[model samples]
Each structure stands twice: as structure tokens, then as C-alpha cells.
Target: MSALDHIRKLHLPDGARILDVGGGSSVLVDALLRENTSWSITVLDISQSALDHAQTRLGSLAKRVTWVAADITQWIANDPVDLWHDRALLHFLADASDRATYANTLRTALKPGGIALIASFSLNGPEKCSNLPVHRYDAQGMLATLGSGIILKDHWLMHHHTPSDKVQEFQFCLFQRV
Candidate 1:
């Protein structure tokens, strides 16, 4: 199953707080809103324009979401969330310090026993995306980079076909905060 499908199957409780890191204009929000389960969703992205596009697409449903325009490495979550989701964001953190800051932010934002679903470029994936270099990882490497507070529960590789029909390998890891 795709990472998004796996997250959908999680069946988190109603009113569960969720943070979607770097979830710019992704349709994941739309899909979740269509589900019967009620979630307090927050979409955090560095680009306001992307968030605005999503808002325009969602129309009235956008009102249900909390949108934050800030860098994940710099932004501190005011409260912990039950679920933290990141898709294709971590790989962009090629710098060690930035990745460390990301890990710290993640630790601070996720509550104990919370679930974190992170997807990144796999080992065999492209070295660069959008002309920017990326740090590819397998499941183990991802866990190490994310640090000690979380334990890997499951991981799998998926092939994503871009609009241009280019296939990109991605590793999706599911973790639980200790």
C-alpha cells in the first residue's frame, strides 16, 4: 500500500490531533477530510502560496484546518500532537545541523506514544530533486537520523510515478514515540 493509504488505515480516534509537516498543496488533507473520522488537522509548510492554493482548492473545508507558514526546523509547536506525518520532506535536509533541528522539533511536537509516519527518498532514488541535492536513506538510516526517542514499527519501499512518468523510490517508515 502507498504511504498515504497506510496512514488512512491507522484509524486514529476521533478528534485526534495531527500535524502534517511540509504538507504544502498535497491532497492528503482532502482525502482525510473525506473520511468519517474527525481529526483536528494542522498543515505546516514553508510556503504560504502553496498553503493558499490548498485553501482555495478546499474552499469551505479549509476552515477546518490550521495552516502554519514556517520552516519546520525553526518552528516550535505550541502543543504536542497525536500523529506527525511527513512525506518527502526529510530528504531535503542534507545538512547535519538542519536534520538535528528537525529531529528536535519532531520530538517536541509529538506526544508520548504518538505515531510518526515519515517518507523519504530511498537509497536507490535520485540524488537530486528539483535541482536540489537530497540525502537518501534506508529505514535503518532514517531511524538513526531521527534519533532515540522513537522506535521503528514498520517500513516499506514504494515506487512513485511522477507526472512526467519518472519513477522515484521512496522509503516509508512508521514510528512510535517512546
Candidate 2:
């Protein structure tokens, strides 16, 4: 299973409000729906088409998810969330300032004791995706960038084999807002 799938397996509180940051067309949203029916998810992404695709794929379950189309770096959330989950999103913000803004947004949106699961390209992974350069991060590096309000829980390395059998390395960091 992927890092996001593994994180979902870790027992979460019932009726938790989850924010899938930069979720787009990722399968995580659909997986979450099939795995748990009570949890409410908010899928936030900059791409309207991506959200549309996800919504179409979800069918009836799509109604349970709130779709927000906005650049996370500049967008401010109106309410706090019980969980913040992002995969392959933070690395897209190659600039320090951009990363800082994303981190700040997470800090502001996560409630006390809320959980955060972030996955980024590892140092060993490909440097770019879709021809765009990505910022690789280790657990300590992610913690340093995200700051002290969120406590690091665990760090896991994920090796994903592409359809062509090429392996991509990813690092997942779990945190809890204090």
C-alpha cells in the first residue's frame, strides 16, 4: 500500500474532518471514501479539471466531499480540520517562501491534536515530475520547515514501482499538532 493508504489504516477518530491538501485527481480521496463512510473529506486543489475528474469518479460519494479550487499557498481555510493529508504536493513548492506559506496554512488550519500526514519526494527519488523540479525532503528537513507547533510522530520510506517497473522513493512524515 502507498503511504497515504498506510496512514489511513492508522486508526483515526470517528467523524473526523479531513483536508486533502492539493488532492486533485489522486486516488486517495476515493480510497478514503471506500474505506470509511463516516469521515468527511475536503479536497482542495488548484486544478478545476482535476477536481471534476475526481468528482465524476466518486459518483454518489462525491457529495460527501467538499471541493475547493484554489492555490493552497495563497488560500486561507475558513475552518480547522481534524486531519491534514498531502502527497506529492509540498515538493512542488520549490521555493522556501512558497513552502513556508504552505506550512503556515497547515498550522493555522489544523486543530490541537490534529494529525498531519505529508509525503514528499525523497533524496533518492526523481528530481522532477511532469517536467517540474521538486524539492526532496527527509523527515528532519520537513520538521524543520514545518516548525515546532506540530510534533513529529513517525517517518517512513516508501518505494513505489511504476507501471514500467521503475522505482520511485518517497518519504512520509507523520505529525500531530500540539
Best by lDDT: 1
lDDT (Cα, 0-100) at 157 in candidate 2: 89
Off by over 4 Å in 1: none
Model 2 C-alpha lDDT versus the unseen true structure: 0.88
Candidate 1, residues 38-151: lDDT per residue as tens digits? 788899999999999999999999999999999998898888998999998899999999999998889889999999999999999999977899999999999999898999
The TM-score obtained by model 2 is 0.94
- Model 1: lDDT equals 0.90
For all candidates in order, the CA lDDT equals 0.90, 0.88
Cα error, residue 39 of model 2, in Å, equals: 1.1
| lDDT of each residue in 62-148, candidate 2, tens digit only | 898999999999999778988899988999999999989998999998999988999999989899976899999999999998987
Q: Give the top-scoring candidate (TM-score).
A: 1
Candidate 2: where is the Cα deviation over 4 Å?
A: 3-5
**Pairs that collide, model 1:** none
Look at candidate 2 and give me any clashing residue pairs. Answer: none
